[model samples]
Target: MDNFLQVLLDGVLNGLVYALVAAGLSLIWGVMDVINFAHGEFLMVGMYVSYWLGFILKIDPLFSWVAAGLFLFILGAVTYKIIIRNSLGKSGMAPLLATFGLSMVLKNFCMNRFTPNFRLLSGTILEGKTLSFGGAIISVPQLVTALFALVVLSLLYWMLKKTRLGWAIQATAMDKEAAELMGIKTENIFLLVFGIGGACVGITGGLMTSYLAVYPEVGGLFSLIAFVVVALGGFGSIPGALLAALLIGLVESFSGFYIAAVVKYVAVFAVYLAVILLRPRGLFGW
Candidate 1:
């Protein structure tokens, strides 16, 4: 029972990070109707930014999060304007292929610049710290990351629920033509949505670099998971993303423990397939 509780807590913590990544992907898809294959590269950029800041500038990893997020936002906006916007109104495959190509380009760029070796940033903040409850142990970094995720999700919820820009985004998502007719600049909204989505992934990058190793191919793994989460949760549903993330996290954790570690991801994939087959519209989609 103690071990089970510990695993559950760990899963929830890990789920929060996945939720952050999925939220960004879902947000972009919801508003712009563009599936950003390069979304994970934005996260990779964030990891690199945090790495450089912590290693070179001697700044704390947490403090450099804002810088990473802003940089990715600008990059996302530019990419939207130059590539995504041009592909709009074309076949769905247009943006898909373009972004897929863009993702490959970014991955190769990182490989050339940073090499394919896995790199890690060592920090004392979360090292060797654990919370114990009834023979269960939880790491400090996991706790901090979970709290950070909560704060970010809360801010996002407030933004989408309260702000004018949020309403614009929502309106645009619901009906782009209607939004344009109502004086909403759909193009500008796309840019903003893309930027915001990138920023969200950037935050995940920063948080993840502290816990995970950095490599050129790292983004691809999470990007795949993000897609599953988005599809499972419903393409554009924030709440659904949160719930699905937690569910995946728990599944991964328990499967790794009770089932073969190598096949744990297979379990996750199986669940994803079952959900999609059973509910084609997703948990909250349509």
Candidate 2:
């Protein structure tokens, strides 16, 4: 029973990381009505930013999160101006294909620049820290990451609910044409949305460096999971995405502990299917 409780606790902590990683995808999907296949690349870019900073600047990943966030925001803004912006208002496949191709370009670019070696950052503040409760050992770094995710979720929620920028974004999402009619600048809104989305995942990527390895293909590992979280949460629902991510994280943790590690993700998807069947709009999509 104690073991079960520990697993439950770990699962809940891990679930919030899923929310952080998927938050950007959910935001981009909600704001632009575009399925950004390249969202993972933004994460990859943020990882590299942290990796290089740690290597060259002697700054830890956690402290370098703001840098990663700003860098990816610019990257996202440029991407939108160069690719996504042009593809908007066309067939849905336009942005999808554009992002898909952009993703390949970014990946290959990284492969060429950094090679395929897996790099791990050492000596971060959260390194070598753990807590024991009964029979369960808790990782401090993971716990901290989860707390950071919670902060990010709260900040996003506040921005969307309490600010003028939030209103602009909401109005734009509701109807871009209508928003334009009301004197809101749709172009700027798209730019801001993309930038905000990029910053979210970028910070996540940097934060994850405390525990995960950095490699060219690392982003792809979480990319599918991020998409699943977004889908499970409902299209364009930030709160829904956050909740779904936490649920999937718990599902993965519990299944990996009690069932097979190999089928853990399968378990998460099974839950997603069940939940979707029951609530097509998702838990908090409305």
Candidate 3:
């Protein structure tokens, strides 16, 4: 029971971080109907930016998170202008292939530049602190990760539902032609949504750098999980993503502990398959 509780708790925290990573993907898919296979590579770039900022400029990853976000936002926008713009409204597979190609370029660049070395950030304020409840140990970094995820998610939700820009985004999402007739500037909205997606993952990467290992492929792990969350929560649904992420996190934690570490991902994938078999549009596609 004690072990179960510990794993469950850890899963909840980790799930929040997963939701943050998935938020942008959901946003882009919801608005632009683009799968963005390269989204994971954007996260890789964010982690590297945070890592290098810490290594070279002596800025803590926490302090440089905004920088990482800003950098990725610009990159995402430019990517849309340069590569993604041409692929819009074509075949269903065009954006998918384009983003996949982008992912390859990014992964290769990072592999060559960083040599696939796993990097860790040291001396962050939340590095080694822990709280124990009975026999279960909760780490400070993860708790903060959860808190940060909650705050960021809340802010994003508010912006999407309450702000002028948010309304425009929604209008565009409902019907692009109608939105354009209403002067919504859907292309800009698409650009902004894509940028926002990159920024969210970038911020998530910074939070992860507090304790997680950094490498070119690290983003792929999170990206896969994010896709699962998006599917589970319903594509482009923020609240759904959060709920699904927590569910996944708990499942991963429990399976990893009770079953085997090597097969924990199998458990996660099993959940995805179950959802697909039972609910193709996702558990909460509505």
Candidate 4:
């Protein structure tokens, strides 16, 4: 029971981070119908940013998340302007292929610059810290990351539900032509949405730096899981993404503990396949 409790806690913590990453993917997919194959690469880039800041400037990742977010926002906007915008209204494969190419470029660039060696940030404020609750021993970094995810998810939900900007985003997503006719400037909204998506993953990357190692190829696994989360939760649904992430987290933890660590991912995908087979639209997809 104690071991179960510990695994539960770990699953929830990991789920929260996965939700944060998936939320961005959901947003981009919901709004632009773009898969953003480069989403994981964006996360990888954000991790590097935090690592360098901590390595050279002695700034903690907690303090550098905002900077990482801002940088990725710029990168996203530039990507839209330079590449994605041109592909709009073309074949659906265009954007997908574009992002796939982007992912390759980013992976190769990071490999060339940082090499394939894994790098872990050290001496952060949360390093070597743990908190005990009943039978569960929790890492402080994981706790903090979970809390951060909650706050960001709340804010994102609120923004989408209450703010004018969010309304504009929704309008654009629903009908781009109609939105443009209504003076929504869907192009600008698309740009902003992409930026916001990038920022979400960027912030997540920074938060995760305290516990996870950084490597050029690290984003692939995350990106794959995020795609699964988005699809499972239903595209364009934040709440769906959250629930799906938590489900994946729990499955991963339990399967890894009881079954086998190697087959944990297989279990996750099996669940996904089952759910997808039943509901082609996903849990919350319209």
Would you estimate the TM-scores of all the predictions?
Answer: 0.96, 0.96, 0.96, 0.98
Error of 2 at 43 (Å): 1.2
Candidate 1 Cα errors over 4 Å, as ranges: none
> lDDT per residue, candidate 3, 179-257, as tens digits?
9999888889988998999999988887778888899898888899999999989987899899999999988998998
Residue 183, model 4: lDDT of 89
lDDT of each: 0.84, 0.88, 0.89, 0.92
Q: 97-205, model 2: which lDDT tens digit per residue?
A: 9999999999999999999999898898888899887877888888888888899989998998899999999999999899999999999989988988999999998
Instruction: Report the candidate with higher lDDT, 1 versus 3.
Output: 3
Clashes of 2: 0
Predicted structure 3, TM vs. truth: 0.96
Residues 1-286 of candidate 1: C-alpha lDDT, one tens digit per residue: 9878988887888888888988889999877778999988888988888778877886656677788888888888888999998898889789988888888998899999999989888864665579997888988766776788778877887888899988988999999899999999988999988888888888778767667778888888788888989999998788888888888898988898878778879988999999999998788888
Which candidate's lDDT is highest?
A: 4
Q: What does candidate 1 score on TM?
A: 0.96
lDDT string for model 4 (1-286, tens) is 8899999998999898999999999999999999899999999999999998988998899899988898899989998998899987799899999999999999999999999999999899999899988878999998998898888888998999899999999999899889989989888999998999999999999878898999998889899999999999999899999999999999999999989999999999999999999998999899
- Model 4 regions lying over 4 Å from their true place: none
Question: Candidate 1: deviation at residue 284, Å?
Answer: 2.0
Q: Rank candidates, lDDT, best first.
A: 4, 3, 2, 1
Clashing pairs in model 3? none
